[model samples]
Target: MKGLTDRQQEILDLIKSNLENNGLPPTRADIARTLGFKSPNAAEQHLRAIEKKGFISILAGASRGIILNTEEALGIPVIGLVAAGGPILAQENIEKRIPQAHNILSNKIDYYLRVKGDSMVDVGIYENDLIGVNKKNPIKVGSIVIARIGEEVTVKTLESISSNQVVLKAENSEYSNIEINPEKDEIVFEGTCVGLLRDFS
Candidate 1:
């Protein structure tokens, strides 16, 4: 209801109509066809933008996880294991959209990275834990970051950064710190960790 564009309001109305008529939310394809979008991806883009504006919450990992006007829950995308050299946020890598309550973490999370190794266990991150990440946050030394080394992605603490070199530190004693020379290696910072979620069940 704030500053939604005409098209956005149209989509929102469509969602409401679908829920009222069919007792379920419309799929991305449904929105695409109704809105004359070329593809479902375009619909998804608009949905995410609306979610950022706090109109709805998108539950990742579900075909229909859109919740209307959720004030207590925020839908955060869940990322599974990334393929080598693939974009970190590629749609295929998203396992599901899960709802995280607003008071769970202070930072505004962009996504949740599913942990795969014990290298960060000393800091409490373990295998299968979903770590919330904020891609917009400024990174500094000691911040735990999601980093891409060549095609591989890993979560480690930012030990240090120099003009020519950068160091990534592992929390576990068994793993050695990763040292890279920026001039020779390709490294990209995806995001910094904000909080974590682990399913004990």
Candidate 2:
């Protein structure tokens, strides 16, 4: 890949490192504050230069919209919430970042999130476990994921028992399975879980 100028690369490094460590890109003000610039506009100038050089993409009109152009995009999709009555990824209530890997995550997806529920305890994912996800799908069987049903979010293991029915199974018995018919209900698969992380420290 083409290399960036020293200052440009330094700026890029800051943004990339922030996303890697914090699970979200930094805002212009954040970049300026970190680099000790006189104003956020100074950081913005550097970012625009980086974007012009094809090192990153800036989501206009949105705060903290920077995205890395490298493999990090495939690293994880943050689990935000569990769908109603389901045990997996729920779109409506998503709240955190989950880290997975490229091979397991779908392309051009969003960040990962931390899971919160005992429904999936049997699968080794306790409350506060991180789950990765992809935005694109034809989600496969046995994939852990986030789903959206009506207005709630939940986490669960996904199971495809038939051509028309999709099942979301909880890892623990304290929860029940959520079955949906794609042809009738408004249930939607938000993303697939691709990675896991535990904070033991």
Candidate 3:
């Protein structure tokens, strides 16, 4: 992670600042203009170096592909645990509830659920990120939600629901879709993911 010159550090700083302010990184053209580079190639070179050092990831062909390897600090509640399998801290399992600062959303968030797996990474909700959940049901079909199945709690996208079955989809295909029969099992929608907080350690 060393070997980055001062100019490269400045580029990294610019990217970080942009993410904090705009929720996304700047484009190559933006960097080139800000740094007084005559051509976008200069910005691209720095970006490649940063990516090589493993501090940032450059998404090929993406308009805004810069993603900081580490994120800024955000104060959020560290809930006990939500199982990726047959485990979710059922209401009865919660023994401690500490208030946390919400950097993304300020109102109506009931609790924060710390993500624990790669099941939702394709959508940029990585492991250890805190998702702001609201008990209020989302009025749309594609809402990302926190759901409870029996005793396990999982975060998934609500793909579709019917009188016969509820389909909970994972953004990452590695995790199979969760299909529940409303008649056979009790699948409860705890809350919708209103905000994403990627405050890394």
Candidate 4:
């Protein structure tokens, strides 16, 4: 009750309800979806605000790991500015945490990616928007993804031409499709974009 608004209080109650009935805390996605938020990042940001007010604690990188009491699991790791040539879930890259994210996803989100460029604007994804990612999701023919090549992390639609030949297509015609040769290129599929967040303010 220190500094939480009514909405935050509702969120805290929601977590408690989910934990009590389902034996786990509500995830950022659950919170966002239930609260009618367009993005899970809204829930994440609210949780951060609540955490700052000393209502909860996050155990970064594991699921259902919010330290509400002594009956929680590990947590979800929220990464900061991704380095050019680094693994996506590297410990050093984590900036914060989400307690857990369940419900409605076979492959749960591994992290939240802040969109950096306009290569996918034709698809309605904008620069500075937050994109939710599931690193383990299998890529499809027209999947929008966040990937890493050398020191650059890019978001694009994935198209596999063969077992080892892949093309990264941008939504904008100004940018050409990037052809990948795994034998010659150090390429890593970071994750698929599952959600997006942006600040109107």
On lDDT, the leading prediction is: 1
The parts of candidate 1 lying over 4 Å away from their true place are 1-74
Superior by lDDT: candidate 1 or candidate 4? 1
Q: Which candidate leads the pack in TM-score?
A: 1
Cα error of candidate 2 at position 13, Å:
13
Candidate 4 ranges beyond 4 A from true positions: 1-18, 22-75, 98-107
In order, candidate lDDTs are: 0.88, 0.71, 0.78, 0.78
Q: How much is 182 displaced in model 4, in angstroms?
A: 1.5
TM-score of each: 0.66, 0.50, 0.53, 0.60
Question: So what's the TM-score on candidate 1?
Answer: 0.66
Q: Which 10-residue span in candidate 1 carries the lowest summed lDDT?
A: 68-77
Residue-level lDDT tens digits of model 4 in 101-165: 57644557777677778999999988877677887778777989887888888899986656678
Off by over 4 Å in 3: 1-77, 82-107
Query: RMSD, model 3, all Cα superposed?
Result: 16.4
Give the clash count for each candidate: 6, 28, 0, 7
Q: For model 3, where is the 10-residue window of minimal lDDT?
A: 70-79
lDDT of 3 at 134: 78
The count of backbone overlaps in candidate 3 is 0
Candidate 3 or 2, higher lDDT = 3
